[model samples]
Target: MFLTQTVPRQREIIEVLFRNGWGYMRKLLTGGKPEDPQLPTPAVLKKIFIDLGPVYIKLGQLLSTRPDILSSAYIEELSTLQDEVPPVDWSEVEVLIRKQLKRPLEETCKYLNPVPVA
Candidate 1:
């Protein structure tokens, strides 16, 4: 399905996989099977997720919770995958919130904090 769709980040994702030495993933994406399938090291897998950006970082975080699927080493490594993005200014966030709300911000809440805690 991904191969059929025109995903904007497809090329970047593939490049990151290749750069991280994830040959198994590259083969899977290109509809090929490796003679000897090999997974990347836990650290390398974490690096791949980090290089792929926020979405992949979140996926890795989710995967970290599944002990049945991933080994302790992988879970340990993925658990540390955090999105290191800079916080958006409150002004920009307020504008987006205002656009989403049916009424004014003042009407919706008595006192809404502009600063982001998380």
Candidate 2:
């Protein structure tokens, strides 16, 4: 049943893994073009956990402290994870801001960056 439902997303998942320079995993997933200078694996892992949602976020939080299981650099990166809502595109954020404030994003703040700071 799980396989039936998620078969559609399998391609997406594999592409994500491969693009993250996890291409060794391609045998288990669809092909993807690797990004040059490849994204930091820790950041990629963080994004995956965030995409997987809250329960996984909680798991990430716990795993962040397990130095024996992950490398120091990975632990440092994982430690930055927070159990907050995942990030969305700035356009969606602008829409939400306007809906809640009942005003355009330009009117509410002195400055708004088109892209969020990571």
Return the top candidate by TM-score. 1
lDDT of 2 by residue, 44-85 (tens): 787776765556677778888999988887787778785344
Query: Please, what is the TM-score per model?
Result: 0.59, 0.50
Q: Which stretches of candidate 1 lie over 4 Å from their true place?
A: 1-5, 26-33, 82-118
Cα RMSD (angstroms) for every candidate in the order listed: 5.2, 8.7
Model 2, 33: alpha-carbon shift in Å? Answer: 18
Supply the global lDDT for candidate 1: 0.81
lDDT of 1 at 72: 97
* Model 1 worst lDDT run, 10 consecutive residues: 80-89
Residue 14, model 2: Cα distance from true site in angstroms: 1.7
